[model samples]
Target: MTKKTVPVKPHRRSTPSPTPRPNPNKPKPGPKTVPVKPHRRKPPK
Candidate 1:
């Protein structure tokens, strides 16, 4: 009765770094105006 065997090592993953882009002559945000109410619907008999 004799059994001994342990050797397992294989795991290396590190490659993903490239993200930096946000700056293009900042100034673009203007379009939001809604004011007009007129709704009346009720006739069914």
Candidate 2:
């Protein structure tokens, strides 16, 4: 009886793409303000 040998495949490595940068010429949005709730006081014992 004769034995057959199998060949091994090479592994591949992937590189990540660069991130996009924001444009400085564009105007920024205004800040938003939230309403504050009224403070409650405890009754005197």
Candidate 3:
């Protein structure tokens, strides 16, 4: 999550990585998506 002070900073570019990536790197199930079970695609790690 560290990106060269401001180089790799997310900026206003885009935050469209929450769903596709599955965000397993966070070690915790982000938000309520884990219990909701709306994603029949990736199915967690």
How many clashes in each candidate?
0, 0, 0
Q: Write the per-residue lDDT of candidate 3 for residues 1-45, one digit (tens) a residue.
A: 775565565659665655666565767655866554566667667
Stretches of model 2 off by over 4 angstroms after superposition: 1-21, 32-45
Please provide, for model 2 over 7-45, each residue's C-alpha lDDT reduced to its tens digit, 9 standing for 90 to 100: 865566455556654876776755744445556545579
TM-score for candidate 1: 0.14
Q: What is the TM-score of each candidate against the true structure?
A: 0.14, 0.21, 0.14
- Each prediction's RMSD over C-alphas, in Å, is 12.0, 11.8, 16.1
* lDDT, model 3: 0.62
User: Could you say which candidate leads in lDDT?
Assistant: 3
- Candidate 3 at 4: error in angstroms? 24
Output the better candidate (1/2) by lDDT: 2
Which pairs of residues have clashing backbones in candidate 1?
Answer: none
- Comparing 2 with 3 on lDDT, the higher-scoring candidate is 3
Better by TM-score, candidate 3 or 2: 2
Instruction: Pull out the clashing pairs in model 3.
Output: none
Residue 36 lDDT in model 2? Answer: 50
Across 3-40, the per-residue lDDT of candidate 1 in tens digits comes to 76857555665556577448657756557444444454
User: Candidate 1: how many backbone clashes?
Assistant: 0
